[model samples]
Target: MTLTAADVPLKRPTVLVADDEVALTDSIAVWLSDSYRVRTAYDGHEALREFGPSVDIVLLDRHMPGLSGEHVMARLNEMSANPQAALLTATSTDDFRSEVDELGFDAYLTKPISKTELLGVVSDLAAAASESAQH
Candidate 1:
């Protein structure tokens, strides 16, 4: 039986990791590379340059030099096919709940984020995207 593209499983989610923390961003790309098409940007401007319709989700920091994460998120929301986004910030949940709620992010993850937690959310979104694509 020849296995074609159709026989393969779901498409890997293309995730944009946008954070000013170089180490954290690189580590996440390394961790998720095998399971996802991961992209990284050191700051908001770079993230905006790299982001496009192909990206399925964005893991964005709440603060960064030049354009801030919230600004980037707002711009992204303006795109016709906006990608799902999550706030990956060090800000306390209580501190940012109202702000995040206003932005309508797919998730809000505080910093020192565990690999398990990251993977869990990504996997869930990936599965949901795949399911939706099938219909």
Candidate 2:
């Protein structure tokens, strides 16, 4: 059976990985490249510039030089079709986690994220968003 474009699954999740750490961002972009059209931004300003309505999700580091994740998240939320986002941080404390969650993220993940976990979260979130959009 010859697989055409429609036959192939629609890789609809386009994720933005905003982090100053080049190595880590590259690693994630590489890992997710197969399933998602991943975009990398060095800082918040770049993230804002690169981000658009087409993006499905944003995986932003809590800390960065130009703009903090919190600030970026707020800015993103102001958009018409706000993209689903999650804070990936090494500083995942109970209080901090709760606070970030309260700000309303699809998920909050810790640093050193396993490939399996990242894939699962991205997949589930994308599926849910697709379903919601369809309705």
Candidate 3:
């Protein structure tokens, strides 16, 4: 049977999650799956490969094996027009406060992040994106 546009599922906002920690990436993907179309990548290169213009938010690990999260963020910024970036790091915020601001991330999240915080950030990013579009 041919499906019409109304028969197709809605296209949710896409979120690219990049982290070296396999378990962490999986967990975050699960949490975000309900609200967003999550794309998971184990390393920076993989993340960069999967990133696209439709991605609404980027949850990136600060210290990956090859390209660091910071590096990936830089590349994403260059490729996409002002994508929302959230840095995931084990280090204290003080360690990267200056760097985060310089990199233009929308949020800074430390490791062991709670699902609530994760969802909140994604919600905020989505809201911001919606607002931007309306302007």
Candidate 4:
């Protein structure tokens, strides 16, 4: 018996979620774990430590002790990683849209994000990333 290409399982996309709030971080990880390979970091520094080329998406809290999400995004940029990144913060979109655009985030979502919204955005980002990788 020979295995065909379709017989092999596709690799799940990896999502790195970083937030200073332990419960929030854990919750998001749990929500995404069913569809993706999810990694959680409790701080910006830990986020950076966990990041690598294999990460397909990033969900970062805009404000954290030690290092902010902005700082982590900058570091990821410095590393030349192309993962789609989202700023998931309590900050209002009106106050942060320009900054989010300038910082090169692929998407932005305020805190209290519903599981449906989170999953939708991640699914879109994952699809985009996969499309880009193929070209």
Q: Could you tell me the lDDT of residue 23 within candidate 4? A: 92
* Top candidate (TM-score): 4
User: What's the CA error at residue 105 for candidate 1, in Å?
Assistant: 0.6
Predicted candidate 4 versus true structure: per-residue lDDT over 1-135, tens digit per residue:
899989765889999999999999999999999889998999999999999878999999999989999888888888888898899878687976887677789988888999999999999999988998899
lDDT of each: 0.84, 0.83, 0.87, 0.89
Q: Residues 21-102, candidate 2: write the lDDT tens digits.
A: 8999998899899888888998999999999877888888889888988778877777655677888888755767666775
Question: Best by lDDT, which number?
Answer: 4
Q: Which stretches of candidate 1 lie over 4 Å from their true place?
A: 1-7, 131-135
Clashing pairs for model 1 are: none
Worst 10 residues of 3 by lDDT: 76-85
Sort the candidates on lDDT, descending order. 4, 3, 1, 2
Cα-based TM-score, every candidate: 0.87, 0.89, 0.88, 0.91
**Root-mean-square deviation of candidate 2:** 1.7
How would the candidate models be sorted by TM-score, starting from the highest? 4, 2, 3, 1
Report the lDDT tens digits of candidate 1 across residue range 1-135.
899989775567899999999999999999899889999999999999999867888888988999788889888777655567788878677866887677757787788999999998888777766666667
Report how far residue 44 has shifted in candidate 1, in Å.
0.3
TM-score comparison, 2 vs 3, better candidate: 2
